[model samples]
Target: MKLVLKDYIESLKEEGELDSLLTDLLWSVGIKIFTRPNKGTRQYGVDIAAYGKNFQNSIEDQNKEVFLITVKKGNFDRNNWDSGKNSIRQSLNDIIDVYIPNRLGKQYNNCKINIVVASNGELSEGVIDNWVSYTKEQGTKNDKLNFVFWGIRDLVQLTEDNLLSELLFPEDHRLLLRKTLSFLDLPDYDLRHFYELNEKLFQKCLPLKNNRKLIKNLRLLRLISNILLKGCVEMNNIKPAIIASERVLILYWDWFKKRNSFNEKEPIKELISYHFFKIQINRIYFAKVQTSYYSEDGLSFGIGNLLEYSLITYEQIGISATIGMSELYEAMVHFPSDPNYSETCYKNAMQVSQSLGELIFNNPASCYPKYDEHCIEINLAMILFYQTERFDIAIQWLEKLISYLRDNYLLKEFIPLFITDYEKLIQIEVGGYKEEISSSILITCLADWCIMLKEDNLYKNLIELIEQSLPNIDLQHWHPEENTEENLFNSNAMRETGSTRSSIKLPKNPIEYEMEMVEERNIFFDETKFLHNNKGFQHIEYLANRHFRTYVFPNSWRQLLNTRFCFNKP
Candidate 1:
């Protein structure tokens, strides 16, 4: 049977009758766009490429870059090709070494090798072994090569479902189906025949009540449905077909509920019901209803209906307030904030928030006993309200929430809010604050406020505090010792008792000005030359400026430090 089909295919090809043959085969497989003679040099290294319009083409067509196609016209021998692998191995090697490198450039590393062996005969067990072994050898550890094998069996299977019969040729479809049927396992053949003979019976068995067997059978039916859907799309009536199928699924669900002992009032049923209804709403929104001049009636209807139904069902069941709060928050964040369409969404969100807050505060046994999540939500709402110019309410809410956090030892939770409020307070200049605060919260707030207010004194004080907190060691050396205050400021002491006083005289002018003068003066003299030649007084002015600029109160304390130290280079 395979030999006869192969001869017929070959005869068609020889007589230049392959256009119809190719069309029939492609149509049967649901391929839409067939590029004939795929006109390119070997740079493309692909033959007969077809693009599926339904597939997204955002990325470049990698199938054009690399593709493995097997064209077989003979009977496929899975066992023989597995046993005698050498002949098939050599054939694959010849293609890779000679055809790829010669036709495509030697630098064409991305080329995919395809094998097309059409014979007017059947392949033996040895031939199958050889093919499998060849493929295995060519496959690298990194999977740089891929191989796909096709035979008469595949062509026959393609024709079994009237795929080719609906197309331009019916006899060829019958022949291919008969050839493919010769290789099928008896059980699969039986199932296929049963479905072919009694389609309605198969559909009835698909939704039976046996829990263990029902899932398996449903999966099989789903596979068949997918194939049929693909066929419909190829034929270009997919939308209507899909709608009809969805309606049937809905009717089936209703029928199953009526017939089965399953309780439709169960929680799982409610969950499934919610999901199914939501899916239907989404489909209607995106599909059936057209846009209106003033509003998107489809979206409004879909979301509004879903929301109303969900709330009614949930309220009846006494659902968790947390679930309501979460859903409300999601709606608010996702949907538009427009006053027209979103007014209901916003009102519902607020209601959910309030109810959730009350539940958390009043019911100790509720999941959220401390109500930390609710507190965060309230803070976010307050922040949003503040942005919207509802300052009085925002401030009230913030104060209450901050006080709650402080009372509960959740000061960490309010740190960010504290910083923001502190900045606002400083901008308004309501209070006079003195002395350093220990909290990181207060320090950050004060630093940011000082920067914003342009209060140089406060800024300098903050910088000094930061410097003092830093580890007092020179990091340039491999072995560094702690830099004591005595080493840093001993010369500036009012008395010589060496107690390392905290108070040091501030520079007469701003430190930046002194540093600039020192930098300008030092540009004229070379420190290496001075050290090498021992020229003591040549750059005295620059040296004096460097000392004055680098140290605090340079004029008053310069003599004390230099009194016992002298640089006499040899």
Candidate 2:
């Protein structure tokens, strides 16, 4: 009763008598519409052209003045037909001026214009009224115009006259007729053929129901049928493109389930999840590219590489791992602590991570063109070293990263030297550097290093600088708006404060610090000298206090100053 598109199409392909039965039904209807005698030949420009009946009316005559009937086959609202009237009228004009005039001579301009519309269900009163109005208008304006409409009730009445029964043959043959009729795009026929065929098939194959191969084949057939039907309906409506794509995926899943039998449910579930996950990842990648965080040209290489690794390495390794057999153990580290884990899942996750890393860091030219290669190279080296827990190497890499940031003038256009390591720093470029700090990476890196070194003061200084910089740095500010926040905070304080504060917490392992106060906003540091003058400190404190006083409570500035400078700390 509520058949999906696939089901309707599959019903047409049924074997046994059902298939033949349906073909006969359609053929009979075709004959009735095309071969009737003494009917006025007029090209109504209907979707279907049928002509027959008299010997004098050959196929050529049918081609010229055949009944141009539009068949609306499914559960469409009658209003749709009413709305389509204007389009139908245009189609009629095209038939008369473009198609019929040349062949029948201009003298046949008075030829009959018969418009017939057939539907599978009854037309609503509103649709009928609209149709009546259109017909009356056409007839009064042009005496040659005529129309005829048929509903499902009319077809049923004809069937009761034994017309359809006479067309049926053997019992099995009747099933084919039913199937054909069910699949036909006949406006005046119900799905009785499909229902009858399905009933017959189920009865005959009751014993073979449990056959695995049969079941599998049946499922595939069903999936294909659904796809075809859904495609047809979508083509008719032109709105369900996305829905149609989703149905295709569903059909694919069904086919996949039938082809594999490994515990059936688990693999199917995992496959579907993986499919959707890949779609999500692609969406995120596209969104990033659209936002300019990634260049368009880089996307082809990045996405292509990712897909290749995923389909080849990940899938192959995963399959092997699932079976408890994998040679990739030498390449992958597995914790023996977890006994129930599958190596394939872990390997797949690692491969995905690797692919994502490639996309993020591979095309530095497009991603970070203004920065010196040495700067990004060192930063990446530091990231790798940090991940491996080689703290000393990471620190060395960070130093190089810092030196590159300070030296590169174009990089300075987007990022101040001090905040280069913060994660929010990237957002600066992304947000168009209008309101918020152009970068947060410097803060993030500072925090990471301080936390690693167990230096509380360095971490505190980083946090304080971030807080102080928050108000002056508007994330919404962009070019031409005067980079006022650009030179507001002393970068020298930002770079040195992390080490200076860390020294207070680790006096024995004190890190040397030197401050280069180029301006209010730009600062640099020399890590060899663990010294920061009180002059630079006073300037930073002044700006912090001023900002706090104006934006926050005046009393809060004193409290913040005391907290930041250790004036009140025990």
Candidate 3:
């Protein structure tokens, strides 16, 4: 709840970022910004211009109103206050003398021009009076001209009043999380208070169509859900948590479904969909956890309705759509007892996955070829086909993935980069800076599928891929696990430690060395330099390892390595 307004302004990185946040805030409060600050060109002192009718009736007798907002950030002490105030006065002079005359002369002649000075530092009473006096001196006879100052206190107050506390001070999530903990601990849990509080909170957010707020709310809910899920499962009582999660999810679903007013072209829609899908994925995963714990065969098919709306609302947004459908399929695919409804969910997921696969193929770069989302469509399509015993069609899709990877990034040019700069390889695997095929994973996957089908045709492709992959990998210096088929097929073994044969031990105290290599191969190869930015490297490692794990290679394929096979690339 402590608003460090100066620190917040400093965190904005650039004037443009702050302007964007201000724009969203203004738009959320029913103020339509007609012009934005052009950083690439001259802005002429006016950072933004907005117009709206009767904003909370702030101005008396106002049919039309306009707000000219200027933003400045600094410590306005005695040393800098005068210069800062003069600079602002100059901008205001330009706005009143030149901008208003040229831009809004006839249209806003009857409109009240509310000149707002939003500053990160304090504005002393004398400075504020001087600012007001300057405006008054310029518009002595013009009653419609008004000046307002938003210093540190005013901006903090604005954030609180507009329910942007969560977006501004993320520490507010801890408060919400505390509330959830207390609610769960209540001996006689009353749904009434839970529902009431949620309704009130949502009502506060309802008017603000800003996606940032939506994303913040979604993140908060996910965090709470995660905490509740852990608490529920650990206590061996999941009913309360399940109820809470379902209630929150229903609220989110309703709110999300009603958001038809947002412009589709805005990048915020992509962000909104990203958080929205994460929320859905978390909610359904929790539901699955509940189902698994209770052994319940009779949960409602209401999620199908949610997915239907999701598919319609965000079908074009492929990553989330594909991920959502995949999670939905996993959640519903187990209920064989309810053949009709479960089958419906499964079929819907299949259809959506097929469509999403085509979407990715059409624009692979958007999906980021290194991202696991890149392979979700392929994994889903193959799994669905394999489940239905459609071996031939599944083989075709599997072959498509194999060909795609081989043609795209398994070339000599790219393979050597991974060998030389293993860190860049991690980056490539995670879709960091480039869109390249994960040769190791795709080869392993194809080997697994060929073993499953006992098809020599695809098996030959796997051999060729292995030949291509092994050349750059320095077999003499590189450690390979025991030639057991089991090790080869275990994607975790291949991904985490590179081979099941390697082992690493951490020091008793981490600070014994400047840095430590967690992976055995990286340590053996003196690859600590690659981990200069540990967090970024770890993120890449996680995504890369996860991408490798998405599709498992069967143990049956390992025996093929023993044969002296010479086959042309398919």
Candidate 4:
């Protein structure tokens, strides 16, 4: 496990990756971080500045001292040590000559300052003589100044001591963590094991009362997430990590929601930190896999991988859109002063929604939904377009998709059903599922979305077509159950879903009507619910779908729902 962590650390870059991790490490270790790494800032030589009790035993001055650290990436050789203005020695000199006199202030003047050089890899042996000479020369300037070098071993040891401590990471937890990193890029893309491992990890944190201990656990969780993301980045496939991160965030939110930990400001801030990290992962996916699926080499994967490749890309677009549109206001609420961020979210939403439309138009396979869960994706994309004021694209895409579903359903059982079996769904495209085609969760949702988008013609056509094509199967649209609030978050909660056939309506202004409709079904989506108008708590069908995916029922829509209201963009 130490080796695994060492390698993970070795993969970090100096500017943002290693820089952020170093600050997180410092916070977890009880250090007061006064200054941190900032991009576009002048080079004053101090990447990090903190004041804390001395942890180093070799230093006899045990009183509180300030730490001035300079961090870089990879192994430090002679070039890195004293190459030019950017060299380690030059940075250390700037910290002393410029920063201390100009910026360190009178408060820190009497305190012993430890100037440290750090990196993920060890300093080369040839630089030792130069380093010792430099430290000796710097020491003569001030008796209170001290110099230290932190190499790979020192970093590994410190991380283990602070973040992945023995008590926090017992042998079993260590094994589970190792297994998680190993299984990140597995062919199945099933993260049940990953979910279970995090459940166990979170469960372990609940009983401990010490605040510092909790910080260790949270920091460790972050380390594990980073390691998994790094592996996905290497493979150029980040969807699994994105899905896994959503699940982990859901698990964490569930814990907070259950305990009513709303008062704990720090954890919420940390939640935002993790949320931003998840968004970064999505950005990476967009940058690397842009149009790769719909390009000439789109369907070039081996037979086994092609189906999943096509299917998940569609799912990715839906997840991204839903997040952007829904969470736009919520994020702005957190940072209310930044009005420009709202525009950024709008731009991202438009880009992803447009990409989804392009994929549907260019790639025939993308137009096909391989599983009923794709309904959630479709709904999310539509809502994004609607909320972001891109209704034309939303309406057109929904109409085209419903028409495609009708045409495909008539020709063959091409519309994916509510089946969780991976092989069963893949078999639908490869050859055909000979079994009696049963109910579909997607078609009904599409009909509802069509109504929401004001496409009365398309909505009526879908209703009539489902009756003619698959007469025996009833189409489902999940609604709130009685006593829904209590059971909604329960493990074995039974959800109520009625046939769309029961309720049929047409409205000229579907957005206003849909708002009323959603309020009637689940009050959480109701903008007027917070007025104490006797409509506060209800089982939001979508929220429950994301929260209650268990082993027995792998709730295929979990990924889409988990990310729906959570924007994954900066």
Question: Which candidate, 3 or 4, has the higher lDDT?
Answer: 4
TM-scores for every predicted model: 0.21, 0.24, 0.39, 0.83
Tens-place lDDT per residue, model 3, 340-378, is 756755655554444443433343232223332233334
Candidate structures ordered by lDDT, highest first = 4, 3, 2, 1
Number of the candidate with higher TM-score, 2 or 3: 3
What are the per-model numbers of colliding residue pairs? 17, 49, 0, 0
- What digit string (tens of lDDT, one per residue) describes model 4 on residues 1-570? 778878888989898788888887778766789998978898589999999887775467567889999998888888788789998888988998899999896998889999988899887999888988888988997888999888888888888887777777777777876777777667775766667778887887676677666656766777788888887777767877777776676566556555555666666666667767766776676656556535753544464566776675565555555445434533444355666666675566567666656655555665677677676566656655665667777777777777778787778756675765777766666776654557766766675666555676776777677667766765555533333334434342443321133233333344443444443443323222322113221112233334353111111122122122222123
Write candidate 2's Cα lDDT for 1-570 as tens digits: 124322343333223212222222333434324322222354344444443332224555542333445544433245465346434445545544555444334543545645555445556665667667867876787676566665555444433222223222234634454454345554333444543443343333334434443333233223333333444443452112222222333323333323433345533443444333323332332233332223333434434443232222222222111111111221232346543343543443344333333333333321222321112222332333333344553443334333333333234444443332334444444454532234333333334445443455554554454444332322210111122122223122222223121111111221321110111012223211211111111112222212111111111111121222223424
Candidate 1 stretches greater than 4 Å from native: 1-65, 68-91, 101-121, 159-570
Q: What is the Cα-based TM-score of model 1?
A: 0.21
Ranking by TM-score: 4, 3, 2, 1
User: Between 2 and 4, whose TM-score is larger?
Assistant: 4
Best-matching candidate per TM-score: 4
lDDT of 1 by residue, 1-570 (tens): 334334344333211123333433443334442334332344122333333321122455434333222232345555323235223334445455655556444433654433433232355665666666666776753255656553445444433332323322235433433433342333223223322412342354445666423332332233233333333333443332233233333323333333442443332243243333323332332232112111322123334443233222222112222223223433444465554435554454454444333333332222111211122233233223322334444343333333343432332222222222434433323343222222232222223223222344544654454454422311110110122112221121212222211222223233442332233233332333422113222112211212111111211111111111132122
lDDT of every predicted structure (CA atoms): 0.33, 0.34, 0.47, 0.65
List the candidate 4 regions with Cα displacement exceeding 4 Å.
58-61, 293-300, 304-310, 322-331, 413-415, 418-438, 466-473, 481-570
Cα error of candidate 2 at position 460, Å: 68
